[model samples]
Target: QAIYNIRNNPPQEDGACKLCNHQTIQRADETEEAITNRLEIYNQKTAPLIGYYEKEGLLKNFLSLIASDTIAEIKKSLKV
Candidate 1:
């Protein structure tokens, strides 16, 4: 649904849509395949850092389901 909305509502940038005349951001690479590829690359790159940080005792994980819960956990972790 988010992907559909972003693709449909492309009015945050400078260029206008040729058909609808709505302003368009220049991110034509926000397609599903592109996003999937980016996620795969992110996981591949970050997987090793997780173990490295864990070994150094610098890893703090927050798996909260709610955004507010996660924010609270982050603040607690940072002693904010």
Candidate 2:
């Protein structure tokens, strides 16, 4: 789930280190303030935009703790 979120919603700027197997982790030279700013924007804006759908009763919250059972639960929740 964590990987999925990170990949689907990457940072505003695309950056990767040459030595780290092209990993998405921010480069060491980047300042801490840059990371904080990105997180703040995500928290203050991006997160809440998607949350609106959940608030409108059109979203399902799966139990991430039960990985194997998530699909079944989501299916049952959205039963037709």
Candidate 3:
């Protein structure tokens, strides 16, 4: 999955989302450098965080292949 965010947008005028009919904007940070920087930041921070959880036997890794599945897993883990 790509790492990026679309801010302040909902597509409309025949460009609505297929499922919700809501406008969706394309991510702006699609450049190779931008994406690489993001991944580097994530790798730098996430490893330590995950290490902490793993040491405590509380680590829960979720696959990001399908967004809905990952979100569902997160929600379930949070119990909310």
Which candidate has the top score in lDDT?
Answer: 1
Structural similarity to truth (TM-score) of each candidate: 0.49, 0.47, 0.42
Clashing residue pair totals per candidate (backbone < 3 A): 0, 0, 3
Clashing pairs in 2: none
Predicted candidate 1 versus true structure: per-residue lDDT over 23-75, tens digit per residue = 55536577678889989998999778999999999999889889999999999
CA shift at 78, candidate 1, in angstroms? Answer: 0.7
lDDT of 1: 0.74
Question: Across residues 49-79, which tens digit of lDDT does each residue of candidate 3 receive?
Answer: 9889899989887888989989999999989
Error of 2 at 25 (Å): 11
Best candidate, TM-score:
1
The weakest ten consecutive residues by lDDT in model 1 span: 1-10
Report the C-alpha lDDT of model 2 over 1-80, residue by residue, as the tens digit.
12213456553344443334354654553556887888998999888967798879776667677766887787778792
Q: In candidate 2, how many Å is residue 66 off?
A: 2.4
